[model samples]
Every structure is written in structure tokens, then in C-alpha cells.
Target: MKEILERRYTLTPFKKEIKGLKDAFRRASLRNLDSMRKRGFRPKNISYYEEVILGEKRYEELKGFSGRIIGYFCTFIPQELIYAARAIPIRLCSGFYDTVLVCEEILAKDICPLVKSSFGFKISASSYFELCDAVILPTPCDPKKKLIEILSDYLPVWVLKIPQDKTSSSKEIWLEEIKSLKERIEDFTKTKLTRQRLEETIKLIHKRQTLFRQLYEIRRANPYLMGGRDFLLVIQTSFYDDIERWIDKTEELCKQLSKEKTHFKTDEKIKILVTGSPIIWPNFKLLNIIEDLGAEIVCDDLCSGTQSLYNLVEPDEPTTDVMLGAIADGYLLSSVCPCFIENNDRIDRVLNLIEEFRVGGVIYHSLRLCQLYEIESHRLRLILKEKKIPMLTIHTDYSQEDTEQIKTRVEAFLEMLKR
Candidate 1:
């Protein structure tokens, strides 16, 4: 009993090693300024990460500091839109490393773990909440919507609502909402989104997107020149880093990856489709686990992956209309994830991916206490089972504390499939 408890409670050597590597990478991210400059890595996404790091660094650098900062909650909302509007869009991500001095009462105990963690971080004086000027949350889930409503009193609040139905296009509805959002931002920042400013923003965004495509193409080439885990870090960094410099590093990496292949030639490997939420950068343990098991994650239904498939409007397309159209089409897809409201489109997406990839099994990962994914997992599993496809369900947190259990379950599932 003692041995089992110890093994379960104690962090594994492998986990520790992975964490150390990530820490080193993070430190490298901070120290490689000269190399980044030499490589002409002027990605705006890199700057985004730097800005947040710098925000915290600036506070630490100065003896005592206090100023306006903004917090944005939820993912896949195109925060660059907010940045162009002149407000720092800090993602409200947190974990167990927090003290809940202020957020406990407002957020409630039953709220989503990530939201609770954010509140705890705010209360604990983790510096994330201390610098927040406002909190913007999109309607990704019911809990999040409620979170935003409650947070309005505590801070400036902005709610980005996604259209509910995809059967009939809601282009006009979304366009109106964008116009309303524009008005609200103008009021909030006292900055106007002039034609020139919008154009500049578009150009910067276009450059970043182009670089992202190039990087992904390199990853997709046979033998996956870059490891899945490393590629995920680059993706996560791209989200918050300075886009231009990140682009430069990505371009360099692409040149290196071009000569390599993406596949492994191992026998008895199970080809799997990773079905679940987006596995963003800096938190790629899940994908690494799959690869380590001799299972290939050939495809994914993550927003961080396929969700960025649609291209932005052409330069000649009317800016307002194109932007609105892009937002609507992207968000209003039939395959929209359950984070908003689990609809039929998600099921269709599962079937489509399975057929397209010729996947042998599906690994369904839901973060611990992620209400949306957890609730939908059972139904998803039933559907897959009915289709005679093998499925594995694993729960995790961002910090990877439950990796061993997840791996055991995954191994067992793979073993069963082999028989």
C-alpha cells in the first residue's frame, strides 16, 4: 500500500525530466535575444509572449510597480483583434500554484477548474490579476459566460458571443456583433480603428498566418521532421509571442525541417486520431505520451490545428465584410467544439476525421473537471463504440500531474486493440 501510494503521489523521474527540459526551454526563450535578433525572428507572436513576460519582468525590475493591465479569458477568439485595439490581452490561465484571496467568493466552488484557478491566481497575488485592467471572456461555455457576467463588477468586461446555429449562415448577425464590438473597444480604449490602422493590423496578421502555415507544412512532411512536442511549443509561443520575430524563427526552423521526414517506421504501431480539445503549446505532454507509446497521432480535431484551416480575406476583399465573413464562417462551423455548446457537428467531425485519416483508434482526452468535455465524453465514446472503433478516455490537467495514470490507461487500450 505504501509503495503504491508513494509511486502514485510521487512525481516520476520522466515527468521531472520533462519539466526540467521545459524550464530550460523557457529560460532559453528569455535569454536567446541575440540569436533571435540575428535570425531576424521578428514574429509578433514572440513579442506577445515577451510582452507578458516583460509585463511581469518590468514589475520585478522596478522596485515597486502598479499600472493598467487587461486579462482575456477563453481561447480561439483572435485576441490580436483586442491588441490592435490597444489593450494588452493577457490570457487568464492559472493552476494550483496560486492563493485564492479574492476570487473564491465570486467564482464559486463548482465553476470550471481553469476559471477557479484563475480566480485563485488573482487572489494569491500571482501578478496576473494584479495587472489586469479588464477581463474579456468569449461565450465558449456556459460556465465561462456566467463567469464573465460576474466579473463585470470586479473589472471591465467584454463578452464575445458565438452564434448558436450553423445550418443557416449568420454572417449578418456576426457582422453586426463585430460592429458593436468595434464601438465598445473604441469606447474602452479611446482609440479609433481607422482604415490605416486596420490595414496595418491585417498586414501583420497576414504575415504571421503565412509563417504559421509554412511551419505546419514542415511538421506535416513525412517522418515529422520536428517532434510533435517541439512543434506544440512553437505553436503556443506563436499565440503570445511577437508575430514577426516568431515568423523569422519559424522560417529558420522550416528550412532545417525541410530536409527531414515526419513519420516513424516502427511496426505494430497503432495509428490514432487525437480527439479532444486543443492541446496548446507549453502543455504538450499528452501528444508526447501518445508518440512514446508507439502510437501515431495522425490527425486532430483541435482548434490549434484544423480550426485555423480557413484563410483570411484577400487584400482586395472589402475589409469589413471579409473580416466579418471569416469570423462567422470559422466560428459557425458544423464541427464547432462542445466548449460553446456540444452540437451534432462535433459527432460529424469525429466520423469525418476517422474516415479521412484511416485511424485505428480514438484517444479522448478531457482535462480534469472540464465540464464540457467530461460530459460529452460518454456520448462520444458510445458513438465510437457503435462504429466498432476502439477508444481511450483519459483525464488530465495542464500541469501533467496525472500522466502516469493516463499512460497506463492508454497502454491498456492499445494492448486491447492489438488482440
Candidate 2:
């Protein structure tokens, strides 16, 4: 019955009018990149991250690469498995508002902008979507579950079923799913995922996660050593950047940060912690406004931010089954995504970040039509209120139509925090 419904949705005719989207998207991307570049105290090695974020260099490099490219949506898909299979994993979550407009022709006007932008890139064959030999999608939400059907029409789509409840039975089910995913990836890459290769990849990703933690620690410096927008760009680049290169570049950036000293006093700027929906690059309106108003975003609870790198895969043994179980636990159990029915983990994470970062205020960014975050915000707000921590929920979409309005509201929130 589910398959029947998916097939019906897949039959919708899509007229791909992609004539000017590429150039338009490029201009918008560069414009946003330049805007971020001109702000705050930027590190000398920041260009390395900028180039990676732009993706032109990586795109050229991949064009001549020998391995198959596998694109996946959501961090739930284990990248270590993709590496073990000798396939490159590229995250397909997009933040381009122009692509959202392009997608509106095919999708409903009220769909989540992130989903629309991602599908838009695929339909137009823009960005790295054209390079993907296959794509893996996790069924974490209704939009993404339906997305698998529409995306199947464009490329080979593999669905990774995510169990909503974090129970022992669910863990067992997820482990089986991980094993199934490993088999599918091996078939796609025509490479056997040996125990040695999986272990090697797990260790390699652990190195990358370690570097991310180092950068996170650097951000914890008094008076703020780095701006949140810059840190976010660095994290977002990990979506497509080479793992080894990303680690090296990030380490270099961290070392540069360590040698520097900030003249900005801690009391001069309010330290704000941003939580809720992922704030992908190029759609950094909320972040830009927060910092431009003189508040430092010391920490965040965003999946696109700290949550993606906070957990490590610690297998009890180097055996493949145990390693896969560890990866399953790392992704599912540690995740605070609102998709789960019980997400007190998210509240706890928020309170912890507030205390750790000395957050003066909390900003909950809810993307329009993203029901999960919007629904979760109410409970989050109530909990934050009880703790006497202030939280401002900004509900918005990808378009700049609400930019001034958001800026105004954020200015008011920062003022209240000061008082």
C-alpha cells in the first residue's frame, strides 16, 4: 500500500527548466560567501574552507577521480560505511534559496525549503548532484520519506529506515539496516567492505571528529576567538570536503586560532546559543543578524553544528558486526533530532550548552514548514522558561522576504538580554 502511494507521487510530471539556475545560484553563493568573509576577525587559512564551501575545486577534483560518488541526505547515513565501500559520501542537504524557487514549480509551495532546495539541485543537475552515482536517504521525517520516491526518478535512491524510538529492539533493527546498507554500498561500488577497511575508515573518521572537537574547544575561548558564521561554514564544508583534507585544513585553522588573542571583552558582547533547525550556509540570515547586532554565537544545538560531530564510534571490538553496532548507536542513540517521539535529550543538550557556553540567551530557529522543529519548539520554550533562560523562536523560510523582520526581532531579543 505504501509502495502504491509512492508510485502515484512519482508519476507527477517535472518540467526541468534549468536554463539560468546555475549562474543565479553561483552568484548568490558567492555573494553570501563574500558577505561572511567581510565580517569578524577571519583566519588566514579561511580561504581553504571558502574554496571547499564553494565546491568548484572539489567538483573539478571529483570529475577525474576513480571512485564512485554516493550522495546521502541527513547525517544518519554512516559515512564510514561509504568510505569502507570505496565510495565517496556527499551530504545533499542544501541551503540555496534560489533552488527553492526552482523547486516550487514541481513541489507544493508549502514544503520545507531545505527539501525543495535539495530536490531542485537534483532536477537541475546543479552542484554535486550530477556527480552522484547513487544516493542514500534516511526516512527520518515525512518530507524525506516522500523525497525518496521523487528522487528515485532521478537517481538510484537507497532508503535507510530510521527507527523513531531509541529502544534495544530498535537498535537491533538499526543494526540490521546498517548491515543491509553495507551490502547495497558494496554492490554499488563493486568493492568488498573488508573488516580491515571498515576499521581503518572508522579510525580515519574518528580523527576527523577529533579535529572538529579541537575546533569546538577553540570556540569556547573567552571573548570569542572565531565568529559563528565562520565556524558554521567550516562545518558545512564537511558535507562534501575530502575527509583527510578537511581534517588537515581544520587542524591548521585551529592552530592559527590558538596563537591569536581577541581584544573584544567578554562583557562587551552577549553570548548567544542557537538551537533548533539546521542553519545550512548561504541561508545564514539568522546567524548574520545575531552577530551583526554585537552578540557572539558561542555555541549551538544545531545538527548542522555541534550535534553532527559530538559523538564518536566506540566499538567494543574491531570486528565488523560490533563496529557496525557502534556506528548504529553513535548515529541513532546520540541524535537529538525532533523526529523522535521522546526527545528530552534535546532539552538536556540545550540546557547543558547554555550553562557551558555561558549563553545569555537562546535563539530557536524554526524553518517554515519544518513541522518537527516547530512542534518541538513549544516544549523547548516551556523548559527554558522554567530554567529562567530566555529563548526567542524565529519561524522563517529560505527567502529574504523576512530578513528585516528577523533582524528587528533579534535586535529586540538582544536588547532584552542586556537588560
Candidate 3:
């Protein structure tokens, strides 16, 4: 075991070693997916989402896709522009623990696990990272900004500079950045982004957002119509699934959920509101622990979850510039990420979700070395305390070493909520 660990961490691992690691990661992903699928009664329509996350179905779909495959990092990158430019945008955020270990060879040990995991995929040529013709990255934090420098070595990387403040000047600056991104994408795809194309794409995504809102409302049922793990899977899959097909399937899932009977009684389990760093697929340790402890996560403020779908692009006019402005505003202004200097919006958003979901308690999940979410969690905890709401902050990474600890803490938190 000691020799194997040393070989794995060596400066130059053999190609066969990398392949073995990739296979291990895939098996781990499948196991997590299977466990999540079996946890609660899942609507049959949701199986499509599981398949997409598993990579096979999405790979088949993208194999036949007619446009350039554009990979993006953060939700702040406007997807409407990619669709308008006749390209497919895949969110490249990853949560596989094995990949994080692979990245430690290059990235500093103190870096956030999410960044390491994502960079690891590129290094290992795992998942869809190899399929991307170009990558778009938003600089929300220091690690991500550095990621742009590192990833540029592999493919064409377009950097979208995010503003720290949300002011009129900041909006103007961001709007210009969006315009620059449009020109870059258009140049890369050799497809002119016309007013009509942008308008059509905006309308199409608006429809998808509407379907997401319907699902969100359906989750508000006193006895959850869908399990939190299953719901997270649906949202996470949206990062890679074909938009039209995802919308259709999600619409069907919502209808199926509307007719299905609730499984647990309202009083049998406590409602939980999750907030903080994005919990990408396969690293669902926090969510699984919460649900396994007899609590249901009715809502969350994670960028990877509800925050990605909550806002809509409301263009005042059908013109391309107006629509682009709307997209920029929707991504920048509506974002509740803690990277922004003023986090009052995040506080208000969490408080609103707690009331809206009738949450009995809150779980603030922070990935190790992710200072943005960790610092914000402290202030948020103080506010929640004043409201007499229970908030538990769990600091963890992609590894499952802390699974038992998290479960123990969550179990205790659920007990407190019940009391």
C-alpha cells in the first residue's frame, strides 16, 4: 500500500497508471449514481438525467451534435451566447475525489478541491474535457483565475473577468466583457451571432427556465414529491444535457411528480435548506448525509443547484444588444455567489429560502480551502442565529474520509431540529 501510494504521487506517473485511475473514477461515479438512484422513489422520467450524468447518453448526443463543443467553468459564463453561436456549452465543474488526488501532483495542496478536480480532468483527459474545442472561464475567485492560466495550455481559453462589486460601472464593464466574449465565440465558431439567432436561443432557454421553476415549485410539497439527491441530480445533469431534450424530460418529470403520492409524512422528517459552495455531482456526500439522517433538503442556494436555474433572461427588447445585456445582468446581478464583495444578497437569499421552504434547519456546506464560501458562512450563521434558525456548517473536500463524521454531525443536527 505504501509503495502504491508513492508511485501514484510520483512526478511522472505512467500512462497505464493514469488509465487505471480514470477507470477507478468512472466506477466511483457509477456507484454514487446507483446509490442515489436507489435511495428514494425516483420518477421514471428522471432516469434520462442519470444517464446524462453517467456520460454515455450525453456522449452519444454530443457525438451527433452539429456545433462546436464549448466547455465552460462557472455558471457566470452566458450559455445563451454559446447556443446563439451554434455551439454546445458543457459546464466542466467536477466533484470526483479521485481526480482531486490526481491534481494534487500539480496544484498546491491548499487549493480548493473543486478547482483541483476540474484541472485533474483536463490533465487526465477524462470525461468530456477532451471533447471541447474551446473553454470559457469566469474569474470569480483566485483559484479559478489561476485555472485559466493553467488550462490555456490545453485549449483555447476565453477569460471572462467578473467584477467584485455590483454597481452601474461594474455592469457596464461586465456588459463589455460579454460583448468581447460574443466576438471571440463568433470568431471561434465561424458563425455570425445574428439578432434572430440570439433571440431564438434566449426564448428557448426561457422555456427551459420555466420548466426548472415548475420543478422547484413541485419540490415545495410538504412531503417531498422528489428526494433531494434526485433533485440535485436533475439540476447537475442540466450542465451537460441537451437543452431541448432536458427541458422535455424535466417537464415530463414534473408532471409525473404532480400525480405521484408523497412518500413521507410532513412531521416524519425535518425540512432542510442547504447553502454555500457548489456541490457538484458524485461529491454528494453532504447531501446524502443530510437526507440519510431523516431530513429532506427542500431548497438550496448553491450555484450548482437552484441558483443556476432560478433567474431568467428578461430582455426589454428583442434586439441582440438588449438581449445580451439581459443575459449579462441575469448572470452577474442575479448571482448570489459569495465572491462578490457585498454578500447581503446571499444572506437575504438564504433567509428567503428558509422561509419559503419552511426549513427547520440550514446546512452551510463549504469545500476545504474554499475561502469565499467559508468566510460568508460565518456572517450568514450570525444572521441565522438571530432569526432563531439552526445552521450547521460542514467543512469538507471531495474525499469520503469524512463521510462518517458528516453523518454524525448531520444526525445530531436533525435531532436538534426535531427537538
Candidate 4:
């Protein structure tokens, strides 16, 4: 019965169109993939993320139970609201290069790769997004803010206005937006966001993030217990995978990791904190280079990494209002995204993390056309310079043309940090 329901739910009405798009994508992607492999850019979590992409393992099992899957893009959109409404929230951000060619044809050639891939995967009827009821996107960056207009033509879309300022005025405005989002969600699912349901869901999400932080804690205290690649796999998986199941497995890993002893002293390896644009799974270019150099990424400020685990919504009361306030306060106010205007907190947190994690330097990576991160890089540079911290910022796209260039720069950065 479960298998039948899953097959039925995922079956697309526009099968012919979907098939043709996918077939075209495969041919174009194979050529690029061969070159990428030749450049030695294999993703660290290929098997796991591939399974997640295909929706064949855990994602399949969960979608087997229900069809109310809500696809979301950024961490700014809370999952607890969807969970509280008795729907599965799956992250729909795309880091897959295979769809980039197909995407570039439809969208502008210079638009961000992430939007292109995500929109392409949707139109192509990819397994992960085929059955979603709606997509919730926050207007954080310019590309993302404009993306909803195009996406709404295909799917039921909800947009949340992310503030450009951290002022008291913006906080109040954002709180109202959260309220509007809740009402929109309620309308979409035909389910009311009750106090009891919201509280229970908040607890579940809180537990999940707590366990995620515990994994990071192990890495911070004993970097040998968890490598950079393995740590990121766990972090990225939580965005779309079943929250409760991910929590159980992460806690189990945390338990096993906690029992392990550090074979080497803290000074044995160069610890680093990574920041800038989100580096989703299968795009582990920066992580691959950094970890390959014997440096451990003790922490990061990426949405796909530590930022997802950075804040906890410690509500004094588990009421819906309190939990909503907590989510707004923790996820938005505490965020380090370059989209915000008054963003000194982002650089301040970087310096604090450098001291806390004893990070040797910061590697700030930005994808092409991502102006916010590149602009923020200048500000972050001034702060790092004053603090006398070594840093490097890399800019590139999905193509592996600049692999050697980045490798040389990373080697130089590591050497500088060592001296």
C-alpha cells in the first residue's frame, strides 16, 4: 500500500514533457560531468545525496506516508510550521550541476546557478520536488526575491519578506510577516496552526538542531572524531530529509563520536571557520580543498552548515506565539546573511568564532553573480585585518575551470596561516 501510494503520488501528469527535458539534461550533463571528474572534483557525499535526490531511501519512505510535502529554499523559512500543520517540509535548493545547462537555457545565462538548478529540477519533474504541494521562499537576496514570480506560475508559492535591516522597526515588521506566513500556510494545508501542535513541532525542531550542534561540538572539541566532509553531509541532509529520523541518526553519531579520544593535540592541525554563501551538498569544492590540506573546518557560517545549527529557540513558554517569536529571533536576527543592511553582527560573530574555535583563518566563498556576499567580503576583510586574522575569498561558478587557481590560492593561504 505504501509503495502504491508513493508511485501514485509521484506520477506526473505531464510525463512526456518531463521525460524529454530529463533526457536532454542527461546528454548535456554527461559531457560536463566527465570533465569535472577529470578535474578531480568528486563530491564527498555523492552516494548519500544521490539517494536523497532520487527520493529512493528515507525521502521515499516519508513521502510514502503523506503527500503534503512543502518545498522550501532558505533556512529563514521555518520547518516547524509545516510540521505543525501535519505536512512534510522538504528543502528544494539545488547544488546539482547537471541541471544547470537546462536551467541556463530557460533563465538568463548569468543568473545564479542555484536558482537555475532548483527551477530546472522542478520543471524537469525531478523526484525530490515532483510531489510538493507548494514552495515557500523568503525574499532574502534579490535573486530569491524575484524567483517567486517565476516559480508561482508552476506551483503554489508563498513568499516571506526577509528584512534588509536589523532595526527595531524591522523586527516588528518581520514578526507580522511571520504571522502572515502562518496564515498562508494554514490556508494552503486547510489546517489551523494550533498552540499544542506548534509547541510539539517546535520541540521536535529544537531537538533536531540541538543534536546538530552536538555533532559540531564534538568536531570543535575533537576534530579527529569527525572530518569536514562527514560533518557537512550530516548538516546538509537535515534540510530536506525527515527531521526526526535525521535527529536519531545524528545523536547516535554524536554518541559514538563523544566516546572517541583525540589522537592528536589541538595544535596538530589548522582549524578554520568558513563563511559566505551557502555551499550545499555535491558542491563541496571549498571543503574538498580545505580538508585535503590537513586543515579541519572547526566551524562555518554557511546556511548549509553551522548557521542551521547556530541558534536555539529557547522559549520560556511552548505556546505558538512564543515559538514563533523564538523562530523569528533566532533564525532571522541571529543570521549572518549579507542581505541585511546593518550586518556588523556577522563580522563580530566571525571574530568571536575565530577565538572560540581557535580558527586559524576564514575562507569566504561566493558564487558568481552573488553580489551580496562579494560586497560583504570587503567588510569582512576590514574586520579580519584589524583582528590580524588570515582570510581568503574564492569566486567561481559550477564549471571547474578555476579549480587549479583556487587550489593554488588555498595552498598560499594555508602557508600564510602556518607562518
Best by lDDT: 2
As a whole number from 0 to 100, the lDDT of residue 52 in candidate 1 is 39
Please give, for residues 1-419, the per-residue lDDT of candidate 2 as tens digits: 02222444445446476787767766767877766766667888988888887777899988877889999988798999999987899888888888887888878898989999998887777788889999999988889998988887777788889998899999899898888888888877989999999999999999988888888887776537778888888888998898888888888888888888555454457989999898887788888888878888889978888887877988889998899989999999989999888999999998988888888999999999999999999999998899999999999988889989999999999999999
Runs in model 2 deviating more than 4 A are 1-17, 261-267
Question: What shift in Å separates residue 239 of candidate 2 from its native position after superposition?
Answer: 0.7
**Residues 1-419 of candidate 4: C-alpha lDDT, one tens digit per residue:** 01101222322222113455445434433433332333222234344533443344654576686548888988888787889899988888877666676667667888888887777787677756777888889888878876777776667778788888888888888888788888888887899999999888888988987787777777777665566666666677777677776777666676766665444454467887888888875667777777777777778888777887667877788767778888778778888787887788888888888888888889998888888888989988988898888889899776667878898999999988888
- Candidates sorted on TM-score, descending: 2, 3, 4, 1
Screening candidate 3 with a backbone cut-off below 3 angstroms (N, C-alpha, C), the clashing residue pairs are none
lDDT of each: 0.57, 0.85, 0.84, 0.74
Candidate 4 regions with alpha-carbon error over 4 angstroms: 1-55, 264-267
| Reference-based lDDT, residue 328, model 3 | 93
Structural RMSD, model 3 = 6.2
Query: What residue pairs are clashing in model 2?
Result: none
Clashes of each: 33, 0, 0, 0
> What clash count does candidate 1 reach?
33
Cα-lDDT of candidate 4: 0.74
Per-residue lDDT tens digits of candidate 1, residues 1-419?
A: 01101222322211001123224435534443322333221234344444434334544532232333457654445544565676555566543322222345544555555666566554444445556776666676776776665555455666667666544555466555656666666677778876566666667667766776676555444323433444444555544444556677767666655544323333235667776755543345677677776666656666555444324433565476565455445444533567544477777888987886577889887766677787887888998989999888777765546778878888888888777
Q: Regarding lDDT, does 3 or 4 come out ahead?
A: 3
- State the local distance difference test value for candidate 3: 0.84
lDDT of 2 at 349: 90
